[model samples]
Structure formats: C-alpha cells, structure tokens
Target chain A: EPEVTQTPSHQVTQMGQEVILRCVPISNHLYFYWYRQILGQKVEFLVSFYNNEISEKSEIFDDQFSVERPDGSNFTLKIRSTKLEDSAMYFCASNAETQYFGPGTRLLVL
Target chain B: EDKVVQSPLSLVVHEGDTVTLNCSYEVTNFRSLLWYKQEKKAPTFLFMLTSSGIEKKSGRLSSILDKKELSSILNITATQTGDSAIYLCAVAGGGSQGNLIFGKGTKLSVKP
Candidate 1:
C-alpha cells in the first residue's frame, strides 16, 4: 500500500537554528496534516493543509511554525527558531477518508 | 476544547487473552473515531468507526463506536506478544480540516 514518507528520520539542531521537516504525502490524497508527540505524551495536532493553504492550526503552531506545499508532492514544516521544548516526534499524515501516517521524523532541538 | 479520554492507561496480559480498550470523547460535530497502534516510531492505523453500534474488524482486532455515549472501544482477541504497543484513540471533529484530537493512549503488554 502507498504510504506517506518523510525525510531525515531523525534531526538534531541547535536551539536557535531553523529546521525544515519534509513529507511526501500519498500522491492522490487531498488533505495533509502535521502532528507531534512529546516523549510519553499524547499526539498533538499542529496544522492541516488543503487546497494549497493552511486550513487550521493549534496554539502550539505559533509564530515560529509555517507549513507549505512547495511542490505538488512535498509538504514541509519550517520552524524559524527551535527550542528545547520543540524536541518531539513529528508525524505527517494524509487522507481521503482514513488518514495514513508516515514513519515520523524525530526532532531534537538542543 | 475537544477532549478524548482513554481508560486503564496500561494493561498486561498473556498470550491468547482478550482485551478491551476504552475511549470516550467530548467534542462537537463529531465526525469519526480512529484507533492506532504505536510501537516505536509512528502510529499505524488500525480502525475507524463512524457510526454507532456498527463494528469494524480486521483479523483479531475489532472496534465499535457509540455515538450516543460519545465513546468507543477496541477489542483484541487472542492477543499475542506482537500486540504489545501503545494504542491510541483519536477523534476528528468541529471543522472541515479534520484534524485529530488524541487521547493519552493505552499501553498494552502481552507476554508469552
């Protein structure tokens, strides 16, 4: 089965540096989403994208966060300034009816 | 805020045991409830329940939604050691975007 794929399975960055997490959602799906899981915490929604724009975002997705579909296949999340609290497992997902998730990118901001 | 609560945060069982995981939610414009299995990295999709009373099943796992009670349950029969994982329950609602609100998850450990 076709699944969502994400690049840089694990990323480590300095606290003030910028990092972009990339995802290639299932080719035919129209809705794309980003979610994060703090170690041992529940998965939290970050943002959702559709029709080439952000549909919704959570408080955690503040000024430092931005998402873009730079190309037809790539959905990317950019964090302008990483923080220690920003360390988490970020998952990209896509859906028509049921959402399918990628293997996830573990971001470690130190 | 939309909320999802899962009961009995951890469960331990032996092979061939049957386990039932519970999830309850409070959200407006509820669309669907989903179950996922998380081993180490990502959460793998298990089942999606949309209507009340109707059950969705795959192999030894089955799930049912109770819209009236705003709850759902996932049942695993004849569980195996491979079934040891964190089971997450998420609900989608309130907008067109369909972003999910997740519960803390129930961790299941099946021993040999």
Candidate 2:
C-alpha cells in the first residue's frame, strides 16, 4: 500500500535558475527512475538509478541534469540551469519487478 | 528505433459500453509490457504482461501480451463514467539503461 511521494507538487521558476525535484521512493524498491511528460507528449525517460549509481539515462538527461540518492530514502534530480523547454510534469517511479509512480511535480520554467 | 505506439488516440463511449485499447511495440529484446491509467497526475499501475497468450485480469480490466504480433490489448467491459482517463502502454527490455519506452497514450471518455 506504500506509494512513492514527491515534494512541492508544483513549482514555478525563472529560466536559468537552479531547481531540485525531490522524491521518496517506496522504502523497499530497488530501482528508481525519473520521467517527464510535456503537456501533450508521451512520457519520456530521464534517468534510472540503482546501487547508488546511474544505471541508464536518456538523451534528454544532458550535462545540466544530475541525480543523487543523498540518503537512504530520498532521490533527487537537480537541474543546474533551467530552460523554458524544461517545463513539464516530472514523475518519480520505483521498480520492484513492476513499477509504481509518484503523484508528480509540475515544473514551470518561465 | 525502439518505440511504443497506441491506436485510437481518443475515444468516447456510453457508460455501459465496452472498450478495447490497442498497443503495439518494436522494442529491442522486449522484456515486459505495462498498462497504466492516468487520470490527472499519477499513473496508476494496472497490469504487466511478460509472456504471450496468458491473460492478466483485475475486476473489469484485463490485458494480454502477444509477443509474436509485437502488440498488446487492454479490455474494459461495462465501462462507467469513472473509467474516463488516458491509458498508457510502456515497454521495458534489454539494451542499456533499463528504462521504459512509452507511447502517446489513448484518451478515453465514458459518458453517463
């Protein structure tokens, strides 16, 4: 019954500024991932994390993006400098054979 | 390129109607196909299909994977207004990065 949780359900930031989206994946899940959905586009993978290292990443996950476990429970995605195109709903998912998603953080870069 | 594609980008049906959503994929070393219901924010997990022929069901929802055809289908019978939402199909498999590839999704609207 446990669900992945994210902080700041919504965020509005100025372009070129730094932002960090936080996620607390299900306690026992092994693999963690970050995905984004543009208003009318398909959900796209950003990055995947396991064993405290990045296992895989998409082209969208450029040098500006970085992910860290930080601790036992928190997985964070930091954007070094935001861009208008970066506005989207970011979801944090945890996989345990099957994947479960968080409610998502709506990021708006203006 | 490895990708997932869904059909009938949008659908509208009466409350008592039945609807079948289709998803086809061409993912490399396909491992599993997953169905999710996205209402507003979070995508609620519905089912995961790995093998072909065998069906996985839950209540009014059922899904099956056809590896040979490189596709899958989700069936919702006796639908209700609450069934309205976007259905997403995603595939995961071999290659690097163990990430899921998603389709644009099918938008369903069940009217009461």
Candidate 3:
C-alpha cells in the first residue's frame, strides 16, 4: 500500500537555527497536515493545508512555523527559529477519507 | 478549545485477554473520530468512526462510536504480545480541514 514518507528521519539543530521537515504524502490524497508530539505528550496539531494554502492552524503554530506544498508531492514544515521546546517528533499526514501518517521526522533542537 | 480525553493511561494484559480503551471528546462541528496504534515513530491508522452505534472491525480490533455521549471505545480481543502499543484517539472537528485534537493515549502492554 502507498504510504506517507518523510525525509531526514532524525535531525539535530542548534537553538535559534532553522530547519525544514519534509514529507511526501500518499499519491492522490488531497488534504495534508502537520502535527508534533513532545516527548511523553499528546500529539498536537500544528497546521492543515489544502490547495497549497493553510486551512487552519493551532495557537502552537505561530510566526516561526510555516508549511508549503512546494510541488505536487512535497509538503514541508519550516521552523524559522528553533527552540528547545521545538524538539519533538513531527508527523505529516494526508487523507482522502481517513488520514494516514508518515514515519515522522524526529527534531532535536539543542 | 476542541479536546480529547482518553481513560486508563496505561494497561497491562496477559496474552489472550480482551481490552477496551475509552475516548471522549468535546468539539464544535464534530466530524469523525479516529483511532491509531502507535508503536514508536508514528501513529498507524486503525479505524475511523463517523456514525454512532455502528461498529468498525479489523481482525481482532473493533471500535464503536457514541455521538450522543461524545465518546468512543476501541476493543482488542484475543490479544497477543504484538498487540502491545499506545493507542491514540483523535477527534476531527471545528473546521473543514479535519485537523485532529488528540488524547494523551492509552498504553497497552500485552505480555506473553
């Protein structure tokens, strides 16, 4: 079965530096989403995208965060300035009726 | 804010035991409830419940939703060590994006 895939399975970055997490959702899936989970915490929604535009976002998704579907397949989340609290597992998902998730990119901001 | 709550944060069960995981939610424009099994890196989709009373099943796992109560339950029958994982419940609502609000999750450890 086709599945969502993410790049840079693991990343380590200095605080205040920039990092971009990338994902390629399942083919034919229309809606895309980004969510993060701090260690031992619930998965929190960051933003949702459709038609190459943000549909909705959470308070956690602030100016530092941005998402883009730069191409037909690539969906990316960019953190302009990383913080210690930015360390988490970032997941990208897509859906037709039910959402499917990628393997996830584990971000570690030092 | 839209929120989800799961019960029995953690559970331990022997092989062949049956387990029920609970999830409740409060949100505007409730769309659907989904269950996922998280082993490590990412959550794998399990079931999506939209209508109440109807049950969705796959192998030994089954789930049902209660719209009136705004809750859902995931039941695993004839469990095995492979059934061990954190089960996450998420609600999609409030907007058309279907953005999810997740519960803390229920960790199940099925021992041999």
Candidate 4:
C-alpha cells in the first residue's frame, strides 16, 4: 500500500529560528492537510490545501505558519519564528476521501 | 466551528476482554466519521462510516455510527496486548475540501 512519507523525522531548532517540515503525500491524493499535537494533547488542525491554495485554516495557523506544495509530491510547512510552544509532532495528511497520514515530524524548539 | 469529544480518556483491560470506546461530535454538514489506531507513529485507518446504525467490522474490531445522536463507538473483542494504543476518532464535513476535525482520542491498554 502507498503511504504518505515525511522527512526529517526529528528536528531541533533554536527559538526565533525557522524550520520547514516536509511530506510526500500518497500519489493521486488531491486534498492535503497539516495538524499538530502538543505532548499528550489533542491533534489540532492547522490548515487544509487544495488546488494549490488554502481552503481553510484554524486560528492556530497564523502569519508565522505557511504551507507549500513546491512540487507534485512534496508538501511543506514552514514556521517563520519558532517558539518553545511550537515544539510538537506535526503531521501531514492527504486524501481523496479516506485520508492517510505520514509518520510525522517531531519539532523541538529550545 | 466543529468539536469532537471522546469519553473514557484512558482504559485498562486484560487480554480476552471486550472494550468499547465512545466518540461524539458537533459539527455543521457532517459527512462521515472515521476511526484510527495510533501506536507510536502515523495513525492507521480503521473504519469510515457515512451512514447511521450500520456496523463496519474488521477482524476483532468493529464500529458503528449513530448520526441522530452524532456519536460512534469502536469495539474491540478478544483484545490482545497488540490492541493497546490510542484510538482516535475524526469527523469530516460535507464539502469538496475534505478537512477533518479530530478528538483528543481514547487510550487503551490491553494487558496480559
């Protein structure tokens, strides 16, 4: 079975620095999404993308956060200024109807 | 805004026991309810229910949805240590966009 894959399984960055998390969604999946989970917390939706444009975003997705599908397969989430609170497991998902998730990128900002 | 709530935040059961996890949601344009099993990494899809009162089953796992009450239940029978994990419930709303609203999840520990 084809599965979504993410790069940089784990990352450590300094506060105020920038970080980019990458994902390769399953082939033929049309819709893409980004969600995050603080340690022992619920998964929170950040944003959804379709047709190379953002469809909807939660308040948590602010100016500091951006998503791009730079190519056909890669979807990336960029944080302009990382904060201690930004440390979490960021997951990328894709779906035609049934969604599939990537292993996730663990972001740690100190 | 949409919200999902799961009950019995954490459960401990012995092998061969039966367990039921509950999920409820309040959202506009509810399209479908889905269940996933998460161990350490990516969550694995378990079931998707678009209609009410219909049961979907896979091996020892089964799920049913109640659209009228906006709730769903995932049941695991003859549970084993391998069944221990966090189970997540998510709801998708009507629209072409296909975004998911997820609950905090129910953690299950099946001990032998």
Of candidates 4 and 3, the better by TM-score:
3
Each candidate's DockQ score against the native complex?
0.91, 0.81, 0.93, 0.73
What value does the lDDT take at residue B22 in candidate 3? 100
lDDT of 1 at A31: 98
Clashes of each: 0, 0, 0, 0
Which one wins by DockQ: 2 or 3?
3
Please give the range of 10 consecutive residues that has the lowest summed lDDT in model 2 chain B.
Answer: B92-101
Q: Scoring model 1 with DockQ, what do you get?
A: 0.91
Give the distance in Å from residue A84's predicted Cα in candidate 1 to where it truly belongs. 0.7
List candidate 1 segments past 4 Å from native: none
Collision pairs in model 3? none
lDDT of 1 by residue, B1-112 (tens): 7899998899999999999999999988899999999998889999998889999999999999999899999999999999999999999997678899999999999999
The pairs that clash in candidate 1 are none
lDDT of 2 by residue, A2-109 (tens): 999998899999999999999999999999999999999999999999999999888999999999999999999999999999999999999988889999999999
Given candidate 3, what's the lDDT at residue A90?
97
Best by DockQ: 3
| Chain B TM-score for all candidates, comma-separated | 0.98, 0.96, 0.98, 0.96
Instruction: For each candidate, give the interface RMSD after superposing the true interface residues on Cα.
Output: 0.8, 1.4, 0.7, 1.6
Candidate 1 C-alpha lDDT tens digits along A5-82: 999999999999999999999999999999999998999999999999999999899999999999899999999999
Residue A105's C-alpha lDDT in candidate 3? 94
Worst 10 residues of 3 chain B by lDDT: B92-101
